[model samples]
Target chain A: MTKKVLVLPGDGIGPEIVGQATRVLDALIENHGLDVTYESALVGGSSYDAHETPLTDEVLAQAKDADAILLGAVGGPKWEQYDISVRPEKALLKLRSELELFGNLRPAILYKQLADASSLKPELVSDLDVLIVRELTGGIYFGQPRGIRTLENGERQGYNTYVYSESEVERIAHVAFKAAMLRDKRVCSVDKANVLEATELWREVMDRVSKEYPEVELTHMYVDNAAMQLVRAPKQFDVMVTGNMFGDILSDCAAMLTGSIGMLPSASLDANGKGMYEPIHGSAPDIAGQNKANPLATILSVSMLLRHSFGEAELADKIDQAVSTVLDQGLRTADIHTDGDKLVSTTEMGDAVLAALA
Target chain B: MTKKVLVLPGDGIGPEIVGQATRVLDALIENHGLDVTYESALVGGSSYDAHETPLTDEVLAQAKDADAILLGAVGGPKWEQYDISVRPEKALLKLRSELELFGNLRPAILYKQLADASSLKPELVSDLDVLIVRELTGGIYFGQPRGIRTLENGERQGYNTYVYSESEVERIAHVAFKAAMLRDKRVCSVDKANVLEATELWREVMDRVSKEYPEVELTHMYVDNAAMQLVRAPKQFDVMVTGNMFGDILSDCAAMLTGSIGMLPSASLDANGKGMYEPIHGSAPDIAGQNKANPLATILSVSMLLRHSFGEAELADKIDQAVSTVLDQGLRTADIHTDGDKLVSTTEMGDAVLAALA
Candidate 1:
């Protein structure tokens, strides 16, 4: 049976970037003995214009039926005037909730060829490879009874409840430990347990789950100390797992350590290994249709999709090596262009990666 | 009339470091003709040993009566086995709560003389000076309904309320704006407003407060993006204000950007501007009584104490310039000593600052 992949080329440079990623995927199927089938659908602004909704039920059904997702980018200034309920960005939240995608994985890997791209000294981040596993569907972000209320004294009080059940924490901890088993077998669970009781339970649940993964070493750190550790010495960590809020902050800090989001990829996964892969950046609306947007991040998303959803680690390695080889060839896109390197167009860089793969 | 200053040199190197700070203060009183009186009190581990409490009632009363408070450091490995209620660290919390020190000010200033000490490239962090204004004594850390309880289904649930009143947000915004007026007149209020309603109200209150300070440029950023920008381009910010949890994380990240915590000072102020000043470092028990601890951070705390509590900007400038001159004179302590720099002990470093003042 051919493995199914659903592609959502949303808006702005989404179509162009996703177009190159598809070509790379096509090359993998054609040259390598791989069995795969993919279908593309419209979403975000384009779908809102064509079908009167950012995400159609028909498209969501296809996504649910597929084994994996390949997403380019979503939302642009054109949809800024739309109501929040029908906005292009709402489609993502709807998909995430509907799919029960509770685990978000973001890997910050700096290729030696682009070592100079990191804000940190090359010695610190040159060989950096750390994966952040964030609990997505739960935590304070989606907790209930969150709003501003008028007090008895006529003063306004704003509140959000941060609650995590044992099961919620357990499942995410399992994801972290399982992820660590695939990597260096070290998992650093970040929490604010020293202060916040919500995360105190989170640490407990993580400890309970760690008993099953005897092969994996687990450690706990305060969130503030974890943030400091990321900047001071990023290479010391292999895999870091946390709640939604902390993951949102630390993952971004880790990405910035690389100094360029143009070449990064991310994954959001459900319990059954079905996942959505996208770049760690937004659609470059200003440069839409100009072929100036970086496609490496999108292409790297393909690498993540294979490894995570399809369990095709070798194929993922092939794609990652292809990207590295092209970077080594000094083929730069406009976004990541530096002096003394040959700057290429979005399509030209994709072509270089395809040639390197061949 | 003489202003009374209360000193609590808590534990380990606290006595030694604060001892040097007092000599510098004494010189200022004698030579500059400033009228100030100070009395020492035992706190932290020593108080726990003496009175079986980290802070005695008499010390608390004196702290309340004093114009400003100077704390050296607190807690050590020896007190690690103490009960949480009687722990030496609890004294600081009790003081913060009792004194109502809601505003926490952390300044990350990369001294030109010690710029190379930073983990970041010297050029990026050379002139870095940004003050983080954190609203202490509130938010999730101290909010109600915080604990772990078993659910009806026998699963445990942990929760904490993240809450802020209009008055609380408004006051802290005022503090941020006023601090900016003293500096470059720019304030970046960080929040998770896009998700959490508590921070949405915080942003709303900040906007309401911004109208009062026409001279200060107030900008709002999501906390995650702010974290990234700190690593990417920290110098772009002047004064950053946020709630307790965020401030705890960002302040530490900012301090690490300076690379050496020994030269950093912190201040916690109440609504009336009476404050507690201290170094942003722990009492190193291992290095205690050896005279190897750096006194710069405690001395710098005196600078913050003079400016915020005493409203004596010129005296603060004198203390700060004396510190800069001492660093310029190539004096160094074990923590921040580099090659070709004169290695000085805690007392010698203090004496060098006194000579610079003369």
Candidate 2:
């Protein structure tokens, strides 16, 4: 019996890049003898177009039963006119919350081949690889008692609560330490412990949780200093764990350091390791159907889907190596292209990566 | 009547840098015929060492009485062992809260001469000069009911309040718009309105306040996106305004864009225009008496002190021009030095700027 993988080629450049990714998935199943079966489904704007909802119950059911999900980018200017409640982006939020995908893993890895593309000096980012494990289900984003109201003095006041429970922090800490165990064996938990008492609880929980993973070293940093250090020396970080809001800022900051924003893949996982993989870059509507979209990120998402959901780390390593080998051979997509690199169409680049995989 | 300017040389490199700044201050009083009177005081570690309190009543009284205050860098590793309440950093928070210094202005300026020093390409930051107006006295940092507590289930929880009143937002908005009027006439107000309802009120207040200064264009950005934009294209901004926590992060991110962290100055202002101007950088305990610490930031603080507090815009322009002239002449402080640039001692750098002023 084969495991089921639900493929959601979402919107704009979604179909183009994800189509290329599926080709690689097929090759793995046929040639590498991977025991996986895939199912394609409508999601995001397409699902909205067909069913008047961004995520239909039928699609949601299929997704719930699948072993893993591989989503391409979603949303574009075309859907900007829709109500926020029914917008295409609501699908992603819905998927995460419904699936209980609490840990969002964003890896900022600077391939040596794309070193010159970074904003920092090549020496600072050439070997950069940092994983940011963001607790997505809780924190200020979902904290209650948040709204604008009239005060006793007749002055209007805007207020929100930043709260974190011990269990919430502990679970995310376990995810981070588990990730670090596979890489550098170091996890730095970032929070505003000195200021935000919510994060003070987060820090305490992180320390308590680390006791369970003695192999992984844990360090702490204030959120503000963490932002500075990302700009100053991003490579110094191995794995950084933080709450939703801080992680959103720091992870994006870390992603830009790689200069391959279009090539980075991310994973959102549940406690049991059931996950959703996707490229960090958005659906580039302008370049849709042009065969100019970079497909490696989507292809890498397939690799992450394999390793994280199916526990096939060796298969994922092969895909990563194949992408690197193609880059080393000087094949370039328009986005990551520099002078003297061979410019290739999306299909051509995808083919080269597949050939290298073989 | 002379405007009383209080000079507080705080700790570590404070005295060395402040001494050079006073040379420029003396030149303005004598050569430029500026009607200014000066007084000296101790603060931070020096005050803690002398009075056992980081800020004394006598010094606070002098600060309140002075028309303007110019401060050098404060705090050092030597005072790291002090109790949290008496720590040197406590002096800053006390001063801001006591004086009701609600507005903090941090200017991130990238000189044409040192453009290569930036992590970004020279084209991105070459002409960058953004003033970040931070609301210092309000928001999460000072909000009430922030601490760890036990839940009904005996699990620990931590929490903080992020609250802002209309008046707090209005005053900072005015400071930003007014500052923009003096620059490129554009203000981008950053908030986390979409998720954090507190910022929804902030957005409302910013828009309401913008009506008062229609000449200064106002735009809005979510805090997370603003962080990305600061790195992506910092030059696109003229002035930015935000609350205490967001400002603390964005302002520091903007400062690093210039790669001149040692050469930036900041001013914290009260409602009446009485202000505390200081370098954005901290004291380097390692080079306290060696005269190796950069004094340009301190000198620049003198300029801000003149303009913001004394309304001596012409004298302030002169100081800015003098500093730029020295940089163009290839005179370098130890921190901002590159190959072929003349590495001048702190005093030499100050003297050259004064010579340029003449």
**Candidate 1 lDDT score relative to the true structure:** 0.92
lDDT of 2 at A320: 91
Off by over 4 Å in 2: none
> Cα deviation of B234 in candidate 2 (Å)?
1.5
Which ten residues in a row are the worst by lDDT in model 2 chain A?
A118-127
Each model's TM-score for chain A is 0.98, 0.98
**Compared with the true structure, what per-residue lDDT tens digits does model 1 show for residues A249-279?**
9999999998878999999998888899999
Shift of residue B317 alpha carbon in model 1, Å: 1.0
- Tens digits of per-residue lDDT, candidate 2, A1-358, equal 6999999999999998999899999889999989999989999888888888899999889989999999998898988899998889999999999999999999999888898888777887896889999999999889877888899999999889888989889888888988888788999999988888898889888898999999988999998888888877788899999999899888888888787799899999999889999999999999988999999999998888887778888889999999999999999989998899999989999899889989
Off by over 4 Å in 1: none
lDDT of each: 0.92, 0.90
Q: Which candidate is the best by lDDT?
A: 1
Q: Extract clashing residue pairs from model 2.
A: A198-B158, A198-B159
lDDT of 2 by residue, B256-327 (tens): 888889889999999878899999888888889997888999999999888888888899999999999999
Which candidate number has the best DockQ?
1
Clashing pairs in 1: none
